[model samples]
Target: MSHSQPDTISAALARGRLGISSVVSFVIAAAAPLTVVAGGATTGYAVTGVTGIPLAYLVVAVVLALFAVGYVAMSRRIINAGAFYTYVSRGLGRPAGAGAAMVALLAYNAMQIGLYGGAGAVLAQFLDGYGVDAPWWVWALVAWAVVAVLGVLRIDLNGRVLAVVLIAECVVALVFDAVMVSHPADGGVSFDTLAPSHVFAAGIGAALVTAITGFVGFEGTVVFSEETRDPRRTIAWATYIALAVTGLLYGFSAWAMSVATGPDRIVEAARADGTDLIFTLVSPHLTDSVITVARVLFITSLFAALLSFHHTVARYLFALGRERVLPPAFGRTSRRTGAPKIGSLVQSGLAAAVLIAYALAEADPIVHLFFWVTVTGGLGVLILMTLTSVAVVGFFARIVHAEGLWRSTIAPNVAAVALGGILAITLGEFDTLLGVAPDSPLRWAFPASYGVAGLLGIVWALILRATRPHVYDAIGLGADRDTTALRTPDLVRHPA
Candidate 1:
């Protein structure tokens, strides 16, 4: 006789935790500092001639805003912690959802792990000024320990800390931009910079790539869904607002940096200042004290970003655990807080391992390391997103509203097409972007990561098929409970 087993989701998830306001703050905070961390390459500054980089950021902000047309629409309909998971499962099936989860795990982790290179490099560079000389990995290990402590804290605590950093950075960057704009070397603010002619000039491609760097952590809104008071409204709002805010902020700074140095000054500025171009541009406008503040904020900005991604990876692991995609271990939550302890532990472990490997490799943790990791990670996420866009169109068809084909079907379809094209162009230009060899290690790692992730999905599905069909059937589904009897958990919480 066949029997039905209790669902892992129902068993795992607990309620009465997160609110909408905090969730909004979390997502916006996460997306803002990506540029300071990732856009260190001269290409971003070179392409747009500094002034045009902000324009490029605005362009992507507009592009992403358009994509959010469908993204928000879908978010309203699908309310699960496992954003990609549910989208794929509803649109495709268990197998596809399973695949997306694997890909997302690898992609997010790669992004997080990539930060070690960035953080270590910045720390090393900053420390080198004071004549402290240890390997970059030494700093990364210290950073990793910090991250591990962060992983164990309350989500709200993380939000409060990030908000302070995000706001401070925004103020610093904007103030610098204002100063640069007010004091242009060449007569006045050039109309040519904002004009379409300058934006698409021969060198604009590199600047556009840098501008794109400002938007990497945009999708982090979904991770806070389970905690949010109203997942749909908050996520929907955060998605658009964060993109716009970060775009404008980065856009203003990039433009200002160009203006401060005058026409054809970005390259020279970079040469004179090295990787400190962004901060250096602002130094003349502020006191030496404020310059120090800006530099410190840059590091803090990365920490905020790390805290945000830490939440994201934990949620992915939690959802996978709750669904039994990987194992029940990930599904287990704290008896007090309802946060997924087991899943958080697993995610933390993986992050630690990746950090250790880079330390062991003794890699030069500069913008180059940051560049390769993000490009690969970005490509990985793009693959997941393309799959999700397809899934959104399909899943919404059967279960969601049947109103306009544009929101659910046509718009997402368009986003998918556009993203695919961008991905193709980016891959073609990877060497150009990095100034590396054709057969460089990154070229292979980028595709290989995607391939490995997809293969892991196949392997996972096979394991589920052989030993855990009940768990397998629950793909893309976040919290589940014992429908037959929830009196126990309630009594435990209340403790009558």
Candidate 2:
């Protein structure tokens, strides 16, 4: 391929097809509000033994918003689909950045594969209602096929589908909240759930971590910056919009559920009906039709989440490949669709392999595949966020930006400290979160794997620096080369 031809292919990502709203839609869909409210809220109540789950969501929102201060600040100056990988490289150097890149790939891929488990389990349940019998992995494979198709299409098309699902998810959640408020139980719409003492009471650490998990996709807004219109403003606005919308929706629904069950009895109620808590509460206030619709939407919620993560993971792989950190072929884009076709296929294949492995092993899809993988994925993401926060401070500290102190220094440092604390708490309480024995191998394996992956990335980066200086220079393509050009550092060495 000629140099310009390769550069043209590298830069192809269906640019200008997405705006702020589209970016928000993708991020919000990734969060999957309906799934969180239906299942996650119940888990939060059971684990925390507190009525202040809403307050926990608010706390996480605030912490992440602070993190976004520096994140968006950097996004404006450095545009790349690599996200944390690119940010860390520019701020922390190529080796550390490469480590972050590998960790991100693991974190996002885990989340995507984990969603397949959840989707398959839920689809089987839906099918069971109609007397259609099949293994959960069968349903999982079907959804995997759908996501693979969408992942290789133009992103704007995917954004449209996600927007529809996201809007429906929000509507159902809001209606449920309204029903709870109108039919408040003995507690009568109490404000006690918002109390600091209540929020920080027993099991607060677990509650806070779960709440943090709910906001995972907010920071992902910048991943689409390359395709978005007016990226600087669009990325910033989308971040704030996604965070505020997700926080309010989650907080309102959780607090309302507590009121529906009576604050003091919410934990017991959630324990009795863990997965069906939301449906159970809503069914009483609405007609049977509403219940059926909610059930169908619940499955769609999982599908939307799976699809959203599929695109994110594909882009991460594409960015790494473009940098020559992975096989160069993985960087190839489709000329017609301007999609990262190879990366998308790779992600789909990986998901298929994992699904097949779980099926052959006869693993419990929900527990072993969904719960175990997502919790581990969430931990990896938290670690990545923490590192990115540190990189933000490092990046800005050395540069001669005229930005304010808060965005450049204080907010990133504070976010780093806050995330570090959360990461520690999560590790300490890992077994509790996974409902496993204290000595379980899973308790150690997940965190250890991420550590090993990061180390390997660092080692590979060092080797590249020593033996392939040209490739090393292109690791992140530096700040001078417009990331939009999509040319990797190694591309310079093999110019046609």
Candidate 3:
């Protein structure tokens, strides 16, 4: 319990620095409501020719809510910034946890770096209007610089930045939705896209996977648990609040787009306007200045997501370092800011390297970099969620706990099955998600990368077991004091 213990002082994040609102802001910013509505939803309609995106978001939200029942229940017992990695380690085994850790790093890095392609493209297009012509990578590097700086500063300061941007983004989205809904096509609103029949029709698999991508960052709630004020309550409230706000925003905005353009024409409009579909729908009703503001908010939305994911990836590294799974250097936090300095720098470096490589290759920033990479990241997360659900059942079954059967067992079992099904569908439609021919190697390559990463992690974990059993045993134990306390029966106990 001593605050000055070398181990605790070395590995601890800034304790009790975040409250519910701050945590919720981080989660929502990562979801990037404006970016998703403007880019993801439109892309889903255009690419899949599916009009049921609104219903898809609602269904994914419900599935995630089921997943959270056990997720938050486990968070109450195990506090770690490693989140999925830590949970899998404790609930499953050290080897699985190690594999989960590698997969998480790959997934989050892909998500974070992919945004630069998006932010860069969006910003470059926005600037072209003002006669400021530049390559997309130039703007991407600008965003990368800003996020790198923010990544090493105080965590709460980053939260404040996200909160400001998220509020404006949500307000603009709702206003746009209202304008679109009020001026429905042919003076009549259509509820066709919201119907179950449309949602369950052919191509529904791709639509559901696209919707799941929009909800990617909500699982990040427990990632900040160790640093939150009253984590047990704050984590749960933030998780649900994030899911509700994002679900409603995405579904409403998508449906409004359908209402603005008749459901029949929604696919055509998305194909024509691409990411600008939402802006184009409202532009005829609003002034040029207001449209400009909305466009700028769209760019900021991408930046906010970059910063949020940067923090998540850095913390995962910090957790791994603290457990000696990687190197102890990763565990060290800045004395002044309590930030994961080494980990943050490492993530920034990786992002910069990827951006440069893509620029050198002359890849299309939006298509090859943004859409393809981020969707692949979403797939990795989907796999992790499925595994974590099974881990929850395993963890609770072995330990003594006060949770009911529903929270401890039933919900997780249901979630595992649900997520596993979605994972299968997503894999089956991976080529569709990437807009590639079914026989293209890119489809298999991206998903296969995670498999390789997971296998490498397992091999490393087994090596650690044989050579460094002490480090292996301490796998998911989190920070220094928590590790000591958790080893005792009073903190967490197993059946005799």
lDDT tens readout by residue for model 3, 1-496: 2465454235578999999999999999999999999988998898778888899888888899999999999988877899999888878888999999999999999889988999999999999999999999999999999999999899999899899999999999999999999999979999899999965587777788888889889999899998898999999999999999999999999999999999999999999998999999999999999999999999999999999999999999999998899998798887778898889999999999999999999999987888888888888899899999999998988877799999999999999999998888878877777877899998799999999999999999999989998888778887733446766642354211
Give the Å shift of residue 294 in candidate 1.
1.3
The TM-score of predicted model 1 comes to: 0.86
Which residue pairs in candidate 2 collide? 474-489
- True-vs-predicted CA distance for residue 143, candidate 1, Å: 2.1
Ranking by TM-score: 3, 2, 1
- lDDT by residue for model 2 (1-496), tens: 4475655355346678899989999999888899778767777676546567888888888889899999999888777888998888878888998899889999889888987888898889889989999989999999999999999888998999999989988998899899987888884677677788954475566677777767777788878887888989999999999999999899888988888888878889988887678888878779998888888888998898888888888888878877778987766777778788889999999999999999999997866777678767878889999999998888877666777899989999999999898788778767666767779987788889999999999999999989988778777653234444444332232111
Scored by Cα lDDT, where does model 3 land?
Answer: 0.90
Error of 3 at 105 (Å): 0.6
Candidate 2, which segments miss by more than 4 Å at Cα? Answer: 1-11, 47-52, 478-496
Between 2 and 3, whose TM-score is larger? 3
Model 1 lDDT per residue over 1-496, tens place: 0135333222444443455556656776666453452244343553223445556667767766756777677777556678776677667776777778888887778677776677777777778878999777778778777877777566677777777777787777677678778988786886445666655455454455555555767776776766776777788877777777777776666666667777577667755665577666666767988877777777776667666777788878888776777676676666545566666667668877876776677665654466567546666776777777777777666552654787878878887887666666556656555556767876566667677777778678767877977666566555533332223331122111
lDDT of 2: 0.82
